[model samples]
Target: MNMKHVFNSNPLRYTAVLGLFAILLAISCTSEKEPLPDECEGSISLQTTIGSEANCGQSTGSFTVVATGGSAPYTYALNGGTAQSSASFDNLAAGSYTLTVTDNSGCTAEISVNIANQDGVNASISGTTASDCDTPNGSISVSATDGAGPYQYKLNDNAFQSGNTFDGLAPGNYTVTVRDANNCEVSLQATIKSDVVFAQVKNIIQTNCAVSGCHNGTTFPDLRVDNNIVAQASRIKARTGAKTMPPSSSGRSLSDDEIAEIACWVNDGASLN
Candidate 1:
């Protein structure tokens, strides 16, 4: 008998052969499904290092972030900002922030951080008062502590200077500002005083001009009163400089030294101090 005729004639044997072919096809299909990559299999992890605090009114704070255990080539973002390849961020003010890291396989990890503020610049100012009204011989010095060092000093809207001491300052109120290397600053009020010239001017007036007949309370420009002397400063400077005051013919003329003293007082802003 022929083999093909024998197989077709056996119905149970034909069904069994068909079932074997179906089992082999299912195994082949299952083998085609690929396994996940080893790199992208694990969970992502994050680590961070908190940075130094910022100074007053400055954005000098910074922090760093590192990621691992997910995939290679990660990106970092701060507070949901644009992603960057670098793990570090800088020039930040004191505040709270959220840092996020992402891997090549889109796996993400995050953490929260806080940047603090440093103590502001601390300073103490001291100075010498002017010796004479005609001279700007006063000086001021500042000693500062805290914050960054190598400090700069400024006096009353002037340019900043590296030196701690400022000379040739006039007698008056002054604003002293001190700034550190980090640009943290503090301000203080100072005063330079001159009692010598003010007293001399008063004495000269009282002994000569402010007497009975000259500039006493009855005179046209009463030099006896402090207010009147201030008001007539310009005239006093002019007349004394020209040697025309105390009237040479009156036999009570002022000496050259006295005239110069009055002129210096008048030129020095005619202040009572």
Candidate 2:
């Protein structure tokens, strides 16, 4: 039979063959479609607000990591350090740092951060000390040549105190720092002369406070005890200045000169005789 005549006679066969070819094509297309890879891609940036450096060699600061053009749910790391979800870091020293951000797709972006100290705080201090064998009284005053106006003061790494003048300090070497409103600081060392002896303080306490149950072992302050003399100097000075001690009804109040003497003693470090 001729090819054309055979094909025309079996139209059903041609239809079946065409249907089979269509099915095979569909299967091939389905098999070629593989799962796509997780594409991680993005960029990172750093923003910072400079933190004020504390007194001495220590410093403080903070920065933030900002990320964009990345997949959702990103993780952050600092200088290849621990991975943290937080984008911000605080209380950092003055120096350089790096931040890296990674997205869910394993794509990473990095940024650099540099920090420097602002010399806004330049402070100097001077003080007078009354150092004699009889009396050891001293005072210190601080001044700032730089930074903001209205500064505060601190002594020997203690908490920041208001005002630049410190009174009733003992005769010794002291470290004083001036901190301005901008939180910048400068430190200075001042030596207060100690001429006042512990013998005088002992005599004064025994003569006035030890009598009539005041500052004796029975009293709350108990000044007769030598161990806590230095510790109570400030409080003793405060009480004496306020005229709250030696109760008015006690019939034996301390004289102004006597109170001043106590201040001098405390300023001299309330030394042990």
Top candidate when judged by lDDT against the true structure: 1
lDDT of 1 by residue, 53-114 (tens): 66687778888877779877999888778999998899976545678888888777778765
Best by TM-score: 1
Q: What C-alpha root-mean-square deviation, in Å, does candidate 1 show against the real structure?
A: 42.0
lDDT of 2 by residue, 1-273 (tens): 354664698987767777887876553312222223334465544454544443334555566656667776778887678989877777765444567888777777767664444555666554464554244456888766666777788888788888777777666667776667776655565767656566766666567655543556555555676755555666767766788655554445677766777776776556664
| TM-score for each model | 0.39, 0.33
Q: Which 10 residues in a row give candidate 1 its minimum summed lDDT? A: 29-38
Name the runs in model 2 displaced over 4 angstroms: 1-188
Worst 10 residues of 2 by lDDT: 28-37
- Cα displacement (Å) at residue 185, model 1: 0.8
- Output the TM-score of candidate 2: 0.33
Model 1 misplaced regions, further than 4 Å: 1-55, 58-118, 195-198, 214-273
